[model samples]
Target: MSLRIDNQTCYFDTDTLHERLPANTVTVITDSDKPMSAVEVAGQRIHITEAQAGALTVAGATAGRRYLRATDGDSVI
Candidate 1:
């Protein structure tokens, strides 16, 4: 027997430009190696699926819901 769930996997990259974050935006978790800091989560990150990332922002995101960025290239994700 096999069980399957309709859920998409997500992957986000750090922002190379490091621009300032706008208002009403939410950050997603990307750091799988280590737990993300609360402060970092609030100020950066975009909770978006890989498919939805192309249209969101950065000329790649696929959905507006996944436009969050770290505003820095060296940002720990």
Candidate 2:
């Protein structure tokens, strides 16, 4: 899965989920080593299927941008 933030809108894309976040909100990406069963953004949680965890990239405004990803048992980036 991948997440992108543009201005006040956030686009979250994955094989099973695609969502647009509200404007001017803080999103806290959870940090967990276990394969993701769900994702939280803007205080909303969306469940996901079991799969190999992927990388995360967050870039945009300073105050509203944040990202977290689960380490694949090796390292956390």
Candidate 3:
């Protein structure tokens, strides 16, 4: 998925992003290779599908959800 944060844009693979997330939280697992890629959109932390990611990449932004940066406070841009 492509997300805009702090005036910069970053793209992440939906699968890789979710694989490191905890069961019911936006926080990622400690062993995540790229923890700085985790994001929450419309309060959704782990259920985003590949199709949705593709759609977001095409449209830039969804109807009501705005892309937030990685919870780690690091800039991927």
Candidate 4:
């Protein structure tokens, strides 16, 4: 599945999400099953799952944060 939330420059997949970030914004997309494990390499698009997006939102992630971290969570519906 895929999603676009709040007009944030990002895309969500089943286990990963890709993003076209704005200037100066850095995102850390960690492996949901493995805590502290960052899966994205530098100079690459941000990856996040839909469930992860919700988790990030619940964990206080916003559109304008300079640094954002998200993890894969269970799907919603």
Candidate 5:
């Protein structure tokens, strides 16, 4: 998968299900057969998906953090 969790030791997929992200937060909308799920952030857990996993190139930012607008065609897995 191109999308992956940004971690030092552990990693996972990064998918964007929506065009806009919630305030001070991100979302993971997925549909995968694999049991893999959720992302780790600031000791908290965010959702992750297999179907949404892929390399995403940021086209622009709407809220504040980098938003995935297009795929850079780079995968972590």
Candidate 6:
């Protein structure tokens, strides 16, 4: 998986699932921080399976905050 940050938005791309599965859980980790509410995937309350050909957008991230880690369940990629 790859993570890209733009302002307060985070874009996550992965190639693990061939089909759209149910929404998974997303955790955005920053320096010494737990998952925050502002971070989300596709604007969903939960992490939904991204389209096979598209990337997942995690919006509402804290401004000026640098994200060092992100995960979907046990699969980081």
Tell me how candidate 6 scores on lDDT. Answer: 0.37
Q: Where does candidate 5 have its weakest 10-residue lDDT segment?
A: 55-64
lDDT of 2: 0.46
The C-alpha stretches of model 6 lying farther than 4 A from their native spots are: 16-77
Backbone clashes, each candidate: 19, 0, 0, 2, 9, 0
Which stretches in model 1 have alpha-carbon errors above 4 Å?
A: 1-44, 57-77
Structural similarity to truth (TM-score) of each candidate: 0.21, 0.38, 0.25, 0.26, 0.23, 0.25
Cα lDDT tens digits, model 4, 2-77, are: 4344444434443444454432243445544543322242344444544654544544454332333453476342
Candidate 1 per-residue C-alpha lDDT over 1-77 given as tens digits, one digit per residue, 9 for 90 to 100: 11111223222335532333331242333444333211132245433344333333333212223224565789984
Q: List, residue by residue over 44-76, the lDDT tens digit for candidate 5.
A: 444444333332112111122233333356854
How close to the true structure is residue 59 of candidate 1, measured as C-alpha lDDT?
33
Question: What's model 5's overall lDDT?
Answer: 0.32
C-alpha-based local distance difference test score of model 3: 0.37
lDDT of 6 by residue, 4-31 (tens): 5455344555554222222223343232
The all-Cα superposition gives candidate 2 an RMSD in Å to the true structure of: 7.9
Each prediction's RMSD to truth: 14.0, 7.9, 12.8, 13.6, 14.1, 12.4
Model 5 clashing residue pairs (backbone):
1-77, 2-75, 3-14, 3-54, 4-12, 4-14, 5-12, 57-70, 57-72
lDDT of each: 0.32, 0.46, 0.37, 0.42, 0.32, 0.37
Best of the candidates, TM-score: 2
lDDT of 3 at 62: 33
Q: List the candidate numbers ranked by lDDT, top first.
A: 2, 4, 3, 6, 5, 1
